[model samples]
Target: MPETGYMAAAVAVCTAITWALRALPFAVLSRLRQSPLAAYLDTAMPAGIMVILAAYTLRGADWGAASSAGPTALALAVTVGVHLWLRNAVVSILAGTAACIALTALAP
Candidate 1:
């Protein structure tokens, strides 16, 4: 068994290493806060993510079909309109999703 002083020293060193690992990100993040790349991503990522999501969601739709096309197009319109009107993501997504589901279900 190790001596008590040796055990305590080992524990202290481990605790310091763990603390430094945990603190590393916060230190890096403070540096990132002033970075130009971070600044651009802050503004661009939201719109880019939205576009990627929209594309992924719509890509599987059978848009050439008359029945599927109308509901899909109208759903997109409703989504854009609601987002423009309310400026709310949850309500807009819900309204758009509801419109798409209801319209597709009601379609012949």
Candidate 2:
């Protein structure tokens, strides 16, 4: 077994590295916030990501499976509805995922 002093030093080093890694992004993001590229990304990336997500989720769905809780279509609808209602991407994605899982799980 390693000595306590050695373990303590390792833990302290790991903790410091983890903290620095977490803080580095915020430090860099402040600089990025002033860039035109960042501004463009801020406007463009979410929509792009959402489009990709929707395409991926729906790509495999059997559109002809007409049901009240049609998983993929209903999930996409829920995602869009939540996004429109709250204008919050994280919440919308999560809500959509939850709706899809619940609907799929409960479907006959």
Candidate 3:
């Protein structure tokens, strides 16, 4: 195990690195507001986020198995359906979670 002082220093360094990485892009963009790269990045960021979310949603899915709840696929499907039908995130999420719980309880 690391010494307390060493662990604290490590944590501080990690925090500083994380903060710098998160802020680096916005800081550079602010200084280069008129750059083509900045404009492209601004529009492409959402697409990148969507891709990350998609990967995360399916990260634990068992594609080989016919059915599995390892990745919460049914919940995701219900949430998306509710969002499309009702256009409400809160309601959809609540309903989806309830549905998942209920279905799980009733599953054989």
lDDT, candidate 2, 1-108, per-residue tens: 999999999999999999999888996688889899999999989989978986764654546444343776788799899999999999999999899888988888
Instruction: Please give the TM-score that candidate 2 achieves against the real structure.
Output: 0.44
Q: How many residue pairs clash in each candidate?
A: 0, 0, 0
Better of 1 and 2 by lDDT: 1
Tens digits of lDDT, candidate 1, 40-68: 99898999998898877677564543447
Give per-residue lDDT, candidate 2, residue 11.
100
* Model 3 segments more than 4 A misplaced: 1-15, 60-67
Task: Sort the candidates on lDDT, descending order.
Answer: 1, 2, 3
lDDT of 2 at 9: 100
Model 2 Cα shift for residue 105 (angstroms): 0.4
RMSD of each: 13.7, 9.3, 5.2
Q: What order do candidates take by TM-score, descending? A: 3, 1, 2
- Candidate 3: global Cα-lDDT? 0.77
lDDT of each: 0.86, 0.84, 0.77
Which whole-number lDDT from 0 to 100 does residue 54 have in model 2?
A: 60
